[model samples]
Target: MPLPPDIRHGGNKACYSPMLDYVKLPTPEAFESSEDYYSTTFHEMIHSTGHASRVGRKGILEPSYFGSHEYSKEELVAEMGAAFLCGYAGIEQRTIGNSAAYIAGWLKALKNDKTLLIHAAAQAQHASDYILNRKRGEGEQIDEPIA
Candidate 1:
């Protein structure tokens, strides 16, 4: 006898993709926790930032051309952007389990570019600034600890 349908799959909708929507990113509500929801949404949003209609990352978003330079660069942007936001918001970093896969993908796109990390770090800074600015209201300064 076959196991229950739920048992066949994890039923955990936290992997950042919709059932019939491979092209579209997962929505925030589809996630179980706010952290997962927000992080996933933020990742996709950062990717969308590169959209040609917007930030001009359309070349990378295409599924057929996976792991190309454009795709790798954008992943760097999204990955670092996620890290920055998680840090800035005082949230725990999400587990990126497929380390080997990510490294391979990035390395392939970069052709093992020595400065890839440096460029990614810079883009992460911009992404962080943008997100912070979006949430900040005029004249609402963040409080710093007294030195």
Candidate 2:
């Protein structure tokens, strides 16, 4: 399925701008592989779900300092959400290692807090579900907290 019209590409950096209600991604050729391109696009798309007009997650809506807990948590949500979307689309294997490494970096910055990881996973699931047109109760949950 194609992304919503509000999401667009063509930017030096990949980001979801809530103020603009849009997502801007770098060119596909900028990534190491097509999988990387899609994964990065998916990450930004996940960020868009936090817009007040969508799922309304505060992490993306509020101002947050770089490296702050809120910022780190949002990064976790975006990466994990993208990973979930990739897995659902059956492209996860191509990007799983990179996704794991990307997520691990954030985990380290967050001091390896298992509880935060769990919360982020839950939020990511919610965000992915939102993007995929799955209502909260319409499908099986896509992410389970790590034991």
Candidate 3:
């Protein structure tokens, strides 16, 4: 059988390309450093949350358009989702020493739009809950992601 994400320490992830042309997150896997893996996955998860079956974010799930409002909102959602997910996952915050630039960029995006953070946070929470609940078989909807 294929390795499970828990065993590989990877979270359900899509192989995402930051460029707007295409983005795809690989399925989650188990890794030794699951917190990082999960954090990254949470970013993607938050985007996928826009799917019709998920949070219904509409148009935001498409590839990120640089300097675009919708893209920035989705990025904020992913960032906030990852942070919140880490909390929900029980992983204490740690510095990989690579987040400063990312944090700054996200902050700028948030500054551009006052509601970006809040909306993304709320969406992240919903996405995180859906993932966790579906993982434990608490809900049946997540198993079928939107097309």
Best by TM-score: 2
Ranking by lDDT: 2, 3, 1
TM-score of each: 0.55, 0.85, 0.60
Which candidate would rank higher by TM-score, 1 or 3?
A: 3
lDDT of 2 at 31: 86
| Steric overlap count per candidate | 2, 0, 20
lDDT of 1 by residue, 87-109 (tens): 66656445243333454567677
Residues 1-57, candidate 3: write the lDDT tens digits: 011122212234444432332234444444446666667666665665565544456
> Model 1 scores what on Cα lDDT?
0.49
lDDT of each: 0.49, 0.81, 0.54
Worst 10 residues of 3 by lDDT: 1-10
Error of 3 at 8 (Å): 12
Q: Of the pair 1 and 2, which is ahead by lDDT?
A: 2
